[model samples]
Target: MMICEINSHSLPVRPRPVQGEATIGFLMRVALANGYETPRQLWIGLRTFDAVCKALCLSAEEENTLFGPFPSYWGHNDFKYGLTAADFNHSLMRWCPLCLRESAHLRGQWMLKLCCVCSRHSIRLLDRCPICGSTQRLERANFDRCICGAWFANAQYVDTDVESVVRITQTLEASIFDKVALPSLPSLSAQEWLRLISYLGQFSETFQPAKPGKIANTHQLDTAMSLMFNIGWLLDSWPENFHVILETIQRKEAAKLSIRRTFGSMYRVLYVDLAEGCFQFLRDEFERYLHEYWRGVVSKRNKAFKPETVATHPRVTLKQAAQKTGVAPAIVSHIMQSELIPYGLVDLPSGRKVRSIHKSNLAQIKALMNGCMAIGEAATLLALPECRVRELISSGIITPLISRVHDKSAAWLIAKQQVQRLFFTSSEPRNVFSAITVRRLLKYWHLRDGEFMALVQALSESRLVPVALQSTPVSLGNVTLDEQEARKWLEEVRFQVGSSMSVDEAAKRLCLKQQVVYDLVRRGLLVTIEDKLPGRRVMRTSLEDFQATYISLAEFSRSLQRAPRWVLKKLHVPPISGPLIDGSRQYFFRRSDVCSEALRVD
Candidate 1:
């Protein structure tokens, strides 16, 4: 009844399409029937690929008898996947040699691109010629001879370990007709799997930056087809096999096992080869595998993914870890540098290794810190002055979470919990423990840095009692010490220096020249007590009284960074006592007057 109306340049002879034959398969068979070199030449002779496609879909009733009514878009799905209709059959000419001899037509099963071995024959399909090492074409009116004049079907299919590959091919082909995704594998649609097979196959080995390889012979094409086939087997089992493949690859490279080296070309293929929407499932599953099994460092520098949807990633960035645990990044780094917390280094373009603690150790970083505080807070918590706390830390009596000497953060982090457990002195206050804290002794006695360290060490060793605790601290101004005990310690320290002052001794104490001290003593502005030694001796109280109210012109000039004459003339601030008033060679200004006028302090 109906006929496929033809153009002037139409195919000469047409055979009935075989039942379930791919439309492209029908074209190749027609090309052979018409004695064309290939299906492409046949389509060219018939004007266009679309023109040939239309005639086949609407052929005469006698030619269409092998199949019933046909839809206009029957084979469009297979034709549109990265190949033009003219190039489709030639580019992917996979076929079973024995099956080709049995029936000289491409089977519907071979149209499943993933089908490596023939379903009926159970032999790997050959795409390239076995004898002349040339890709086999749909020859003119002949199925036996290749373009190189060799018998194509006589080539025996080599048997190898293709069981998994064959099985995977069956699985992927099943997904197409059944319209169901395999439950064990990632749930990708049929079209997605069809397009993704060859794209994913190249990632099976370490990626060389060369061009796409040519399949020169049957063995080479089989090897190439096996790559696409192996992908399904690798994915069918899920992560157990996935991890095995990665480890195997690492073993082969013999280099360090970083994810970047492990999944060499996979990342490039995912991020750059395919669109994100097409292979999103594969990308996500691979990323999950990396996060779960790959115990390597990950960052922006390497191609490993940095996708963290939830705040609770096992391996988080340094800043994220700090924000989650309420710890400073510097403290976390210090913990890692001291090897208190274990960490690994991620790759960076700058070659700076980031400290990456495992989730287990990351949690411990927060636990080990009962909480961090400034040194001042630590001193207050321990009921000791900041200076005393610093001394204790210096002498290794207390261990801080962050070492003040080692870090440049300028904030010493001491564990408040560690400080609370310290024992500054006996709990009960006796008469020996005075109400006055060591803070007062520091100001009153002018303790040297070494003497202060010794005093704190004595307190740490239980040699003294702290009678009072600071409910609140004015920068650690209070931590009680016995007044009598403190006085006795200072007296012993003073007596060790002897009861006297040579002119040099007096000048050093007063921060003046020897000549100035001599003139001041001669003027009776400084008093000297008797000493058994030959040197002139100034009493301890004398230096204190002299320095308390009056600042000499020499000290004033040094403080202002000017000469004495410049201070007297340009400053217009007269001294309270001088040669005219005190009969002294040295001019002395009151401390308040010098501070207010020379330094512009209120």
Candidate 2:
């Protein structure tokens, strides 16, 4: 193993010896592909993580904080992030080489691990317990020791801490390849040469080219790479037939590159050429983050905030309420019928079937199940439909599938498939008859026998009693306003008089004002005058007539080059003024009198 000094720390790195004829022959025999070789530098970090925190050095604290303390990596597929020794042999063993080495080291440190049954462990991402559902704890065997008190065979254990193991693997490989250059091996004996040839054959058959290639085949490629590296490690020098192998791999890689380029170009043309698509992409990502952050903040706020009075809000349906309480739909349904909690549910209309039940009901189910349950029975007990129950099978949408049920009404089962379909298919549209269209037709006929007959005749001519779906009037979800609502809506007009405007607040409520509003009141426009506010009166003056005839006193005098008749009369007839009695000018004339007495015409 080669070591590199990083930050004053000696770290094991990858090994790459100088090239030679025998090694080149081996690589040629294996048909080593070029694209398959992702540069070691690309994976330095992942390899380092594994090297620094190998199984031998890993403590419970380190396992939990750094590498996965458990037997599996948390977020990726079994083999992703890193590899291990076992990963090379079994598809199920997901470890990468670097990860495998580190994991081995980690197990050596732990020495002994609790068994699956005794430790009460399950797969890291699994919701359903693998063994003894009642006991949710199951642990893995340590590198050197098993839960059965037996020493580990060859001290070999697969470490699920992917990232750390990957780092270590890369670090080791880098140091070995770049810093430590071992000399080429001498010709091997016939038996040894045959074995090496056989291994090379296997490696070539399994070789996978990565990048710009099919992503689905990544696992296969990863496996081949692991095997190749192992063989390379046994050989002292670099492979010589690299040129031919690299060329073959390059052809495949080129195909992938072309495909990637074509699709990328198409996407750019569709989204970026004509608009600000790059900005939109950034905006969308930002908005998504903002929404996530806000949602967390809201949840925290809701938990922290308290109110003096708790509203007795109606319960929403199980389908709608599942997201809020973090409870499965089956559990929610089971609680709905749960009499043990002495709780009742109320259904509230939110344009959907929503019902809410007390949280205590759920506690009862958990107690009965003893913490966990099998997949099938949990759904049965929850009284959920079979389809709905199956949908949650992955994350255990429902915690404890009820195995036994004494009461038919109390227990429900929702199929796991059904819930998946419901959630995934929410965007689909549903078919429904439009009642508004029928109502409009009824009004058009007005219950008149002749009109109804005419309509029937039209339908009959179209070869139907009821209109054909394609021919049916589309529903608008609305109707023309009726007289009462129309009148009420029209009552908010304001009338300008001098510097101020006049409006009837009551008339405003009626949606009318000024002369039209006043006229309506005078002609009993409203249902009743007693309904009007006190001191308010209606008058009769069409707005058109009023605007044409009326002018301010000052404007009228200016137009005539003399005071208006009413103003002159008002000056001649003085009014009294006092604290008790307000002072005012009084003048009046009929339209006929003004027409006859006015000497000038404008």
Instruction: Report the lDDT tens digits of candidate 1 across residue range 1-602.
Output: 22343464465675766655655566667667766655555544455545665555545543332211112232233333233222123334567788778876766556444556765666777777788867654434354577677776788786645566666566555554454455555555455665566566544434433332222331345554766555655665765666665565555543332565555655556666665575676667766765664444455555335446222346765676788889888777777665666666555556666556667776788777866788888777655667778877877656677874888656787765556545443345455534566667776766754777666556666665566433322222455767877665655455454445556676876767788788877767778876775667787678777888788787778887788777777655677668877666778878877777865521
C-alpha displacement of 400 in model 1, angstroms? Answer: 9.5
**Cα error, candidate 2, residue 517 (Å):** 99
> Taking the tens digit of each residue's C-alpha lDDT, what string does model 2 give over 427-481?
1233433322323545452332233333233332432223222442322112122
Candidates' lDDT values, in order? 0.60, 0.30
Candidate No. with top TM-score: 1
- Clash count for each candidate, listed in order shown: 0, 96
